[model samples]
Target: MKKLFYFLFVLGIVSCSTSSDDTLENQQNPTDLEPNKAFVYYMESPKVSSLQPSWYYTFNYKNGRLVKMIGKFVKSENIWSPDNFYSDSFTTLSYHNNKIELKFSNDTYPTIVYTMENDKPKKAELYNQFNELVTVKTYTYESGKIKIYSKTYTLETYYTYYLDSNNNLIKSEKLEKSGGLDKALTTTTYSNFDNSKNPFKKLYLLNDNFYEKSLSNNNYRKINYTIQNLQNPEYLPEIGNAEWTYQYDLNGQIVLHHPL
Candidate 1:
């Protein structure tokens, strides 16, 4: 049941929120940060990491369309070693006219059908294998931001993206509601951006709706969010923050992320 929920969570069914971070000075110059056209090749898993939003994905595209996205992730807040373990998952993308479908590995149900017009994603729908539940997400894009509204039978999530001039995510705010909109369950903020070209910059052509593996022009420096859904304030978990430093490839693109 835990694994079942985890799979559903990744499908943007259980939760759909964007990400942001605070910045420290980037080691690379703004001009030098101009990234080359590139594809994500790999992600290094640190032996110890407590990053809140932790999974990383490497994507493949053909004819300017996404073909596949493979995820590599460790247990949250775990000290990974020979004794501990990690896992991976992947989704395959198939494009149709004005729409693209992302299917899980070896599954027909639990897929995301993305609708695009003029190559910009307008809506996405997630269907269970039984087709019993449909989770829908609608998008609105502006010069420096992206807004997403997601709805399921039980809840709704509103996402506001604040971006840099280069269209990199500067901050991400999300509001979740169960009965009706009132207060947010959490607020996420991102800071610190390196000028290096994002490894997955081309992914913006597909979509920028996900928070964990961002499709921004630059790399996220940090992620901090506080949960507000708890009834007992004293029992609320201490949600940790994620901060990143990066390594650059030859073409001035981010090659790897080091959590600080």
Candidate 2:
């Protein structure tokens, strides 16, 4: 069964779409460019919502690997299960001007290789299978986004960025490593703009822990969510609000998805 759909497409639980170039295509216009050639967007989520709409299993990393994947469908009584179908691609070294190598497989199984060093990468290292050095990563990259620290595996990871002055990648924020010892998994953040009617505003704090999600279009149709809880001292509570109603055809895609 192709290794059971490649372990349900790398355990995405189902939902995928592929067409890579590291996304940002819809005719792009992030302010007209220059900030070091910005065009980065990546996200993956297992699940963790302070309220609702917290599902993302994404992929697409250009000169690096992880090519593309963006698919979705969850019906149930309507019956749909191939493990759910979420699996993005490009997980084997593609390009790393500074230095990059990554290989991880599922369907055929037994494959894992990760190596990254683009100027200090938190002084990284993770090699096993007799290659030696087990694990280590203490990375950092600003402006373009990337933060990783592995206090001997306690794990701490991040990728955050949102641009519009023509830098592209309207938005993306992802914090990783969840489940069991970490208890449950997934934190997500992704945003986009320019199909204007409004075209701006994107926020996500998620498993960095305070819990937050926001995506705005001013009006155009509605995709709004605002949640907060910074450990509340006097922030008081009544918290509740959600909206998702969109439809865009004529090639722009996004057919329909409602919740209001």
Candidate 3:
């Protein structure tokens, strides 16, 4: 549950946000599916032929809070590397208080740092290989939606979210500002929740990251299917009309997700 996918869609490119840190003190306990270790197989699609190299992630916790994640890619039969293949992308994570930092073996910088308030994400800081600050994003919550503003040395963008009564994020809209002019970019919507589950809830709670808000106190609840609609397609054409199905383990963590 990297949450990389949703973060890619909504955040686009931005930095981090910061706010009060006691927001998550009363949050519900994590789901039974919480993983100390897991494997994720990357595939282009559900078809067997689309299976790609896999990744393994291990988590470490301190006083019941997730404090670290280690990830490494595992080569599959499709790879034709030499007898000894060396990967330059082994990743490591460090979590302290409400902040989580990521680093890769191939990177000279700390990659990214996420800061959370309560159980909600407030900011994210992106760094280059040299460890220099590249971008920052700040988030503010109003009503039931979260407003995000991202800034970099070169550009700035804004995004808004609309949530359902359950606090599950249902829609997102992106906007860009240039020379006092504001332009709409895209509007994305999600639907067909499975029961009361918001699939990525546990990831958000423990990882100190936020892409969507959940209303359920139980992280074990699962989203069995989801449909995404895009008002204006840009990079992801399939999102304009796509359906996704998720399968979970006995512990309630997702094991497989396929498009239908």
Local distance difference test values of all predictions, in order:
0.57, 0.34, 0.51
Positional deviation of residue 230's Cα in model 2 after best superposition, in angstroms: 34
lDDT string for model 1 (1-260, tens) is 99998888797842433211101112112332222222222232222343333444556655444577665333345344322222256677776656667777544455888786554669889888886647889999887878889888878898888877777666676677777754455666767877765554334433333333454666766778766654444566446566655667586666554342
Decide which is better by lDDT, 1 or 3: 1
TM-score of 1: 0.64
Model 3: per-residue Cα lDDT over 1-260, one tens digit each = 46888787566544222222222322325542345544333211111223223434555554444555555343354455422222334555565667766665654444778787766668988898777898888989898777988877746778787776766656676766555455336565656655434444444532221234233322222222222233333434232333434466575545533332
Higher-lDDT candidate of 1 and 2:
1
Report lDDT (Cα) of residue 163, candidate 1: 77
RMSD of 2: 20.5
Residue 83, candidate 1: C-alpha displacement in angstroms: 13
Which residue runs of candidate 2 sit more than 4 Å off their true CA positions?
A: 1-141, 144-162, 166-243, 246-260
Worst 10 residues of 2 by lDDT: 33-42
Query: What is the TM-score of each predicted model, taking all chains together?
Result: 0.64, 0.20, 0.58
lDDT of 1 at 6: 88
lDDT accuracy of residue 250 in candidate 3: 72
| Predicted candidate 2 versus true structure: per-residue lDDT over 15-79, tens digit per residue | 33423332322122343211111001111122211223433333343433233323332223433
- RMSD to native for every prediction? 15.7, 20.5, 13.9
RMSD of candidate 3 to the true fold?
A: 13.9
Q: Candidate 1, 163: how far from true, in Å? A: 1.7
Superposed by TM-score, candidate 3 places the C-alpha of residue 259 at a distance from the truth, in angstroms, of: 17
